[model samples]
Target: MNHKVVSLFAGAGGLDLGFQMAGGYDLLWANDNDPDAVSTYKANLGNHAVLGDIREISSEEIPECDVVLGGFPCQGFSLANTGRRADDARNVLYLEMLRVVASKRPKAFVAENVKGLMLMSKGEVLRRIVADFEELGYDVQWKILNAADYGVPQRRERVFIVGTRHDLEVDFEFPTPTHGRKPDSGKLPWVSVGHALGGLPDPDSRHDLTNHTYSKYKLRFNGYMGHRAIDPELPAPTVTGRGDNKGGVVVLHHPSNERRMSVRELALVQSFPLNFEFACNQSAAYRLIGNAVAPSVGRSVAQSLQQALKTAKVAVKGD
Candidate 1:
């Protein structure tokens, strides 16, 4: 963790953690509007997070750093919500990133979003994002990457955009997947949902695991784990913030205890280490986890950026 980084829209420090795991970057600052998210960021990052909306912060006030990382809000571009039209006000948040990058002039940046961004507003929205960075004098490269590809068991796919100042003479490539593409052993293959929470207690053993469920849904999906230990062999189900209130997906409980998965367990699924102390309560933890980039995926992206920067530095020295 030698490289310095500033994180914006840093929900639960997922992207930041990933960079750390990749073994080169030190987080200098982080920002998020959600109090719970900010709490989680500060708790885990230990004084690195700024804890506010991006629009509220002045770039000059931020510390200088080598890389900027964030997963900007995508409500305006999500295909899940049909109302996300071209004119949706939220779509412009990319400008906030452009604003920060233009002001901070970091060596590089990594911005991620839902895969739906590709088709949003018939692709005009994505195009505009690319154009905006280019307008800011950056050479941008983008691709849609999957979480499962990077070693996490989740099937999450996101669009990753990397930008560098045009004169840097750097072209970045996305990291190649390390897990799903190759079998870990000749027989067992990569890790699975069963592997991730293998020895944990069972949800059936605890009352806390069922407290948040609707009685009818609870009875219907009885074996489903909500906030419980999950099957590790499969990539994790998408982690959501609403687990305390509603049943969005199957969350497997530990085999020995009936309670849902703990915050620490959730973090592991997201690829955070055992010691990562998330701020806030269960609900807040869920939100942060939901919004974070998987550390494994971040590491892959970081490797690409590191190489790109090295190449850029060499070209400059040669010149």
Candidate 2:
């Protein structure tokens, strides 16, 4: 069958690339608010993403599609924000998705966000979101996924809420973890940071020196902002979407070097191809990378969705 996807919150095309690479979806349209992200998306994924705020774009303008993809703004629901509330403006952004889904009525939809969303208001926020989607006639399900378990050399945990139109026979099962420290699950050991960054030479070669460049002043406030050096022996912690290459940002320091991890190295850890450029300054590059859905994790979900679609069709035919 065909999988035509219309994506919202399409930042730098991470999730979009994953779905396209997973090989069922033909991306019909995509949207995002950031100019740089839209530029990067066009550069890396071709010209599909529209540059504008989702709130302003009416649902009628969105093309019809089988799946709707969103990586909604997570700050309002993130643990980093202690002042979050049920009425937080950002918390309601998913309603924009609801608007589009209600208007387009896609067969399936998927939304990704920081894991903190599950704990917001002791989970009331999540319950409400699920209820709203259910009211849309979707069979809703969600799970917290750790990227390390899905082949990315990062342990970033995220929540994915997937919905199938109520009438479909297939249920969306979150993909099982394929990597862990213990042996009982028949899974491979988690990919270490070394697995991704071990091949680079000392950060002086032009390629290394240029791409692996760091903020000289960042070391001035060393150890501030909870910044720590990365450990190559294990998967990295969650990669945040903001970094100044200078101090006053969140980034893991290079395991071997004193400087912060460069945009390329960060992209590698996020499972993005080496050739995939961020097309922005160092800080913007760091910010976009930090904010993106890890492509490896996105691919895992896309693959499962594809399977569910196939199974649902077979069931319908048999009946």
Candidate 3:
């Protein structure tokens, strides 16, 4: 059965693409305020994505679907944001997601945010969010997932909150790790930057690779974010959307420690496909890639959801 999906804050279609890759998912509708993101989603994925603020577009505009997926704006809850505030306005964007879910009442909904969200407000914030979802007549559960554990070549961690309608009578199970620090009986070692970027040509000597351009910001090894040398042998540090004072997006240095990784390279580290093009300028492309959910990690979660829904259907038929 093909499950319909409606996505919000669909930046460059990373999460939506993951669901599409998982099979049995049809992206019926999507929305994002960024013009570049909507353009990219249309160019690569489909033209179903609408361009507008979620707040302005009412739930009535969205079609009914089996699932609601959102990676809601997380700048306020990110640990890398030194200027973050407890009452940061952007933190409430998830409410917009909740409003739609409340209206549409899909079989299940998935929300993603930075790992720092689990610690926000001394954990009170997360508790309250979970409580609110439970009040909507659903079984809500959340966990922190590391992308590298799922074959992404970056050590990015994000919290995923999943809710299933109580009537479904199925508990959602998060996917197990397929890659790790040490190879286990059934798992492979975490993918390294060297392994991920092996065949890409140097940015200076490009050979028709799209969006293969790097930032010229000089490297600084001050131990701060995006300032340290990368270990090619290991997974890359988290890619962030912050940038230098001159307005250039701060991208991680290449494994060779010579220059910053290009937009395409960073996208690769985030597990985006080679042909997935970002329909924007270089700096905007960096922000889009950094803010995206790694497609591989998203696929794992999607697959798990697919399994849970299938089990629920079987149980209903058995009854």
* Candidate lDDT values, in order: 0.70, 0.82, 0.89
For candidate 1, which ten residues in a row score worst on lDDT? 210-219
Q: Would you list the rank order by lDDT, best first?
A: 3, 2, 1
Number of clashes recorded per candidate:
41, 4, 0
Which candidate number has the best lDDT?
3
- The clash tally of candidate 1 reads 41
| Candidate 3 lDDT, 218-263, residue by residue in tens | 8888877888889999999998877753325469988998888999
- TM-score per model over all chains: 0.82, 0.92, 0.96
Worst 10 residues of 2 by lDDT: 310-319
Would you give me the overall lDDT of model 2? 0.82
For model 1, how does the per-residue alpha-carbon lDDT over 6-62 read when each residue is reduced to its tens digit?
888888778887787677777888888888777767766667777677888888888
Candidate 1: where is the Cα deviation over 4 Å? 181-188, 202-233, 241-262, 314-319
Angstrom error at residue 189, model 3: 0.3
> Where is model 3 poorest over a 10-residue stretch in terms of lDDT?
310-319
lDDT of 1 at 220: 26
